[model samples]
Target: MPELPDVEGFRGVMQRCAGGRRVDGVEVRDAGVLRGVTARRLCRELQGRRFAQPWRHGKWLVTPSDGPALVWHFGMTGELLCAAPDDAVEAHDRLLITLDGGRQLRYRDRRKLQGVRLAADEAAVERILADLGPDARGLDLSRFLRLLSGRRGGIKSALTDQSLLAGLGNLLADEILWRARVRPDRSVRGLDDDELRRVHAAMGRVLRSSVRAGRVPARRGWLTGRRDDAEPVCPRCGRPLASGRTAGRRTVWCEHCQR
Candidate 1:
């Protein structure tokens, strides 16, 4: 699945390929990926309009045109591609937007799990996004602490909850917890201030490095690199990592390093 860093990378794709470009045409290769709006409505609303700025909230990306905003959520296997107009459309090229520069911006998804939608304005955009909590990259220590102070779920659950904080997926949740020396199964409400502070700091550190690298880096020094290995061990302590499910997502953590 495409997480925050992956979406951020797609936002960069939007910036370089679609920003400042006028919509010459909207081609729905496979309408299966669209939500609510039809191909005709999408073309009527977006064709001829220019994409001024692209924005992202949580896992959603907003491409503001003269009228409706194009929202994208890269479900399990969604991606944005820049290709030539005559370039052979891949098997998963669900939608293609022809830009003014003769290049095409494609919405590609293998499973068609999630893709594109059209929002009328900023308020409409907010309505679709209101359920998401504070973006993880922008969260502060005070707010992070307050949100986790009274949660009853496991620490991993609280970390991955979109209502508590957005953008963290299973891997990030496990990575952050392990780095902070907090157990994944611990109840959130029972954590001490020290643990919460460590979590906050860990989030910042992880996000900064991931953003810089354009993905959740699976470095040898980090648990992410080794969790799926045949003989996975914590880079920090050389202790073996364990696997289970938390918040309904498969999880991996270093028992010795994380509490």
Candidate 2:
């Protein structure tokens, strides 16, 4: 899944590849990936307009122009790629945009679970965005503590809950809890003040570091690194990492390190 850091990286790609230059053309290769705006309307609305700086919230990326904005949600296997005109097309390139300056941007997704939406105005933008909680990268410790104080779900589940705090996915939730020394099964409200402090600090550190790296690095010394091994071992404690299911996704944790 393309998470916050991944979306942020794509935002950077949009800035470099499509910003400033007028949208000479927009080819909705697969109308299945577009929402609210038809192919003709998309081309008409964006064809002559220039793309501005893009913003992201949670896993959603917004590219605004003078008219309706293009909002993208990269589902489980989606990505935005920038390439030259003659570059070979990947099999799943669903939406392609051509700028007047000759560069091209392509949105590729194998499973088109969620795609694009066209928000007509700032008000419409707010309608779609109003429900998202504070972004994880800029989360405030005091506010996060307050939110956690009344939750009954497990720590990992709470972290992955987009309504509580946006931008965290399965890998990040597990990694953060592992670093905080909290078991995935531990209820959110069960955290003591010290434990909450540790969790807050750990989440901040993990999110910042991963966003800097442009993804959950899955590197040595982190749970993400060893979670997929045939017989995964804990990178933090050298103990065998356990795997099961939680929050309808595969869960990874080190029993030795996490309480």
Candidate 3:
């Protein structure tokens, strides 16, 4: 799934590829990937407009134009690629935007679970994103604790809840919990102040590293690197890792390392 780090990378791509450049045209290869706007309207609204500085909230990417703003939510398999005009299109290339400098931006997704939305103005954009909580990357420790307070769900579920802390997905939740030495099934209400602080600190470290890598990198020595092994073991303790569903997502944790 495309998480916060992945979306941040996409924001970088948009800034480098099409920032301040006028959009020449929009070609909707698959209209099914568009939301709240038709192919013709999308093309009409975006054509000849320049893309201003892009923004990202949680997993959403926003590219503001002179008129309607282009918002994208990359679902499980979605990605935005900057390609040459003559670059071969892949099977799932859904939307193509031609830029003034002959560069092209492509929205590709295999699942098409989420796609593009054209917001009429800044208010519309805010309305669209209203359901999301404070972005995890910018959330303060105080706010983080407050958000977790009174919540009765498992720690992993709370971490992955978009309404509470946006941008955390299955892999991120597991990785953060592993780093914090907190069990996935641990209840938030049962955590002490020290444990909460530890989890908050771990979240900061993990997000910074993951954003730099443009994804939750599966490097050796990291929990993510070992989670998929045939017989997964803890990177720190070498104990067999536990695997089960938490918050409706496959969660991996070290029983010994994470209490």
* lDDT per residue as tens, model 1, 39-73: 88998999899997898877788889887899999
lDDT of residue 253 for candidate 2: 88
| Candidate 1 global CA lDDT score | 0.87
Question: Using TM-score as the measure, which candidate wins?
Answer: 3
CA RMSD for every model?
A: 1.3, 1.2, 0.9
Q: How close is candidate 3 to the true structure, as a TM-score?
A: 0.98
Q: Point out the higher-scoring one by lDDT: 1 or 3.
A: 3
**Clashes in model 2: which pairs?**
none
Give the per-residue lDDT digits (tens) of candidate 2, residues 1-259: 5888888888888888987777877888788888777998888888788788888999888999866788989987788888887898877899899888789999999989889888888788878878888888877888988778778878888888888888899888888888999888888778789888888998999988888888888798888888888989988678898888988889998889988
Global local distance difference test of model 2: 0.85
lDDT of each: 0.87, 0.85, 0.93
Backbone clashes for every candidate come to 0, 0, 0
Q: Model 3, 234: alpha-carbon shift in Å? A: 1.1
lDDT agreement of model 3 with the native: 0.93
